[model samples]
Target: MAGPGGRMMAGGGPGQRSIDFKGSSKRLIARFRPERATICALLACVVLSVGLSVIGPKILGRATDLVFAGIVGRDMPEGATKEQVLESMRERGDGEVADMLRGTDFTPGEGIDFTAVGDVLLFALGVFLVAGLLMAVATRLVNRAVNHTMFRMREDVQTKLSRLPLSYFDKRQRGEVLSRATNDIDNIGQTLQQSMGQLINSLLTIIGVLAMMFYVSWILALVALVTVPLSFVVATRVGKRSQPHFVQQWRSTGTLNAHIEEMYTGHTLVKVFGRQEESAKRFAEENEALYEAGFKAQFNSGVMQPLMFFVSNLNYVLVAVVGGLRVASGSLSIGDVQAFIQYSRQFSMPLTQVASMANLVQSGVASAERVFELLDAEEQEADASPAERPDEPRGRVALERVSFRYDPEKPLIEDLSLAVEPGHTVAIVGPTGAGKTTLVNLLMRFYEVSGGRITLDGVDIARMSRDELRSGIGMVLQDTWLFGGTIAENIAYGAAREVTREEIEEAARAAHADRFIRTLPDGYDTVIDDDGSGVSAGEKQLITIARAFLSDPVILVLDEATSSVDTRTEVLIQKAMAQLAHGRTSFVIAHRLSTIRDADTILVMENGSIVEQGAHTELLAADGAYARLYKAQFAQAVAEVD
Candidate 1:
């Protein structure tokens, strides 16, 4: 697996079957120590197999020439030297040589003992057997290490996704990122495991065979070399053409997966809106695009193998014609001609394997580039300084002309100033998109202010470590998230001190959640699904409130905490809030006027500035922006009563 900064972790799955390592050469090298034992074993196997195999072919050619020379009475014609003769005989079929020297020369039925041939054949067979065993073991070992690395890569990518600044997800698509981590990595794995294994073995065989051919007939080897480069050129051209198509294929796949995920998540919405047909049509468009891209990529890459074989076959014909002539003219032995045929196939096989793996290499490279891009992402900055420890519970927070925006050019909070004294409940009232949430966000250190500073007890929030600053305050948002766990676990989330069952129950009762808890089959022990999706929104909200109460922080922030419930629940929540906010400084954000009526100060905000600020009655007396809002809510309350 590739780590942050493009370094591969020690363990990864086997090399990709398709593209091999592609862009991760450094990662592969970093983990080379684990692979070293396997590589050494594989190299040993290849050396033994190739050396023995090459020698045997040459040995058989010499044996044939020697027997023919004896028949023609011309001292073997000296076509090959004594060393070449021995090698040619060693290269032939192990069983044939064994049969020829089955009995001693002293035995009556023995066929003119070729015992040296038997000895060489036995050695070659032993080498072949050992090589085969070692190669298999090496392949398995490499695969295990590679698989581990791939698993780490997936894990690292997931951790990055979670820790990345929230802003990163705003611009990137979920499905595209998922594709990079999952499907792309799997493709790389498959290519490494199967094709890469074959490629290595085939490559070694080809090189060994080529060397032997050079010794046999340099001219014929040159002719074969010409065809080798041509095959590579063709494979390269085809791969270059196929690469864009493969990338498009994966891109389309991501789009299709995104739509599918969306549809599944919003099935109820789709059904209610009667948009199934339209959804299917969109899906079809994406699916068709994927098919076209896939066909183009696979089709082009698929043709490369056969093209290489075709080129190899042409070279084979030329070699056979040229070699046969040399043999007939008494310049080459019949055994030499036979050996050339075997070497031709050997040289061609590696090229064919490479051609077949070319597309895999390209695809892996494409996927690797995407993976590296994500791993290279800039992490959200965290304060490196040690957390500051305040002497006393000042609980005072002040925004000194604090201004901020999600985008730098577009200001959300413009020269906004607010102050909350220790033990004061400050209610922030604003129309939609009036930087109400933005103010709280700054206090939470979720986003940095474009200008000005927010201070906790006179210390800039930014100067204090984010965790420490958040630790001093508790927030209950409009949407509550509860992990899949028991109710007790949920309530204890942000608590600084250890919470007992009694404390948890006390918090729940204060939030009016204890009433519903007794009705549950398992009560506080009931397991919640992901995000508390199984629970009602009102109940989830009350649970979140209980959580805040349990935390018992010096500073509190309630952002529409009771807005999603019934009137009765709202009343109960108000009582709980009154209790929870008794001593601690609080910041309440709400659209409901009644919730904040008892607040020490109410700030009516419009645009990015406060339009009105005073006590409820004082604002009503002013007959300004607060007065207009109060009148509207009062009228609605009267109409509901009627």
Candidate 2:
């Protein structure tokens, strides 16, 4: 049940544990299976584009050799023709090179063929243009696929959240859950959109460039290949070492965000306690930890590019030095040597990209793991198959030797039995932490009973679907919740069917909320903020009462329903409650002894067991736990009045 923040450092910022990269990556890859056709097409474009890029340097090298051949032929003696010069050049054992140089215009006195050179330059430019176009198309296709895939992933995560049980949220911070939903998903989307295509293109370029380099000159290819292992060694080592830091960085970010959210939401409380300095100190500590983690992660990732660049430059030097010797010995042409140098440089470019992208991939995988964790969390039990449905349910209820506990080691309720006839008000009074609310929770099926059974009208509540059982009961809690919407909409929130404006107004009047609501400028149409900030606590409570009234439930449960109101408002709310409970079964959990004096039966609870049960006069005569509680409250009220 411990959330991400609990796993973080004590008195510091957040930290995270490592996850299984292989499993997460496999799941992430499976998300795109539906887009296989688009991926295949993207791959085709990549191959076409990389093929053109790989061949361009070699074709341009042919032009360089052509220019060289023309210069050599132009310097030939007057008696010797250009063809004779070419025959001598062919004897140097470059037959393929000689064939490529054929049909080029060259004269004994002329320096070179400008027209032929222009044609070769134009052909190279055309190849580059075609490759650029293919690259553009491939980029567009990748974006489409990435965005669609992300859309589906987000939808799945959202759906999963709804299916998760209330218990899952009880142990986690709101900010932590939101961070996974927003920040983690965004990271996954960005990595896939920006880095995925680059990863594919870099890999293809590396393969194609390597093949071309080997074809041009195996010796130079071998020299360049040496950097491959060195690059991998540096990247793999640095990447693995930096990954934990990146995970820590993200976890710290989520923790810091959660802290900020809590502080902001409770700013009034912090100020009231004059704890500003303490809050700032805590924030600074967390911020410092985040800074440290981020610095280490970025620094480690940054080292890869420069080191790979150095390796590439060193390989280029070796290729140049070696190829020059071959050219000088007439074993290789100037054009061939130039082409080999380009290929050597191209080979390392993709390796450098892959190294640079390695850190981002690691961060992305970390995010994916968190997202997958949420999706894989335990969900609420499914509704009973062919679930029972009761027709026109009566309000009679019973608990048969029920035992319950929040923590199994510490027993709360044990061997308790109770029964209530239809249309009777049963008041439950208890000290703090006496399991009053826990009993209500069990009855509502919020938490299943650890032992025994609770029933409504002899039908086991467990056999009925949660929705079916809950539909007949209305709950007005001490903490009232109102969403951002019109006041009328809030009041009619849980109605089984559409409620008329007249019905809404009637319910509001019955809850004593109509007078105050009418004072607002928009009246029932007034828009409330998310926290019902504009309304007072008493008013918020009234609205919740009105919501319950609108539902017209068969049974009502009010947990300290009048706790927040002033004395005058409390009296009015009491009257409203009297009218609402006249003919319906109601369970009232109240701390105010005077409020429940007229209850048909009063149950005095302590710890988790009912210690006293009787009418008010009978309980007082017994001089037991209920008598002591009523006397204590009466004395307290008298002291307050004096």
- What is candidate 2's lDDT per residue for 1-642, written digit by digit as tens? 223554324233223566577788899989999899999999999999999999999999988977987786677665667577568678988665455445444566666677888898899999999999999999998998989998998999899998787678888888878888999989998988878889889999989998998898888788878777888898888887788877787777777778888898788899999989999978976776677778778888889889999988988988999887777665677888889999988888888888888778878888898889899999877777887765667798899999998777999999989999888999999899898988998888887888999999887888888888899999999998899999999999959999999999999999999999999989999999868878998999999999999998988999998898888988888888888887788999999988898889999899999999989999999999998998998899899999
Clashing pairs in 2: none
Off by over 4 Å in 1: 1-121, 195-206, 330-336, 386-394, 495-506, 531-533, 637-642
Most lDDT-accurate candidate:
2
* Candidate number with greatest TM-score: 2
lDDT of 1 by residue, 1-642 (tens): 434555332221212233333456455445445556666765676566566666666766555544443443332234544344434545774444323322112222223335655664566567567667766765775577567657777887898876677667777777777777788778767766765566667777887888999998897788778787788789778976777776666667777777887787678789999999999978876776676667778898998988988998998998898876666554566667777877887788778888888787767666665676788897777674765656686699898998877887877788888888998999998789988887888888777788999888888777788778888788999988788899888998868878899999999999999989878989999999765756798999999999999988889999999977899889978887988898889999999998899999999988878888989999999999998988998999999999
- In model 2, which range of ten residues has the least summed lDDT? 6-15
Q: What TM-score would you give candidate 2 relative to the actual structure?
A: 0.90
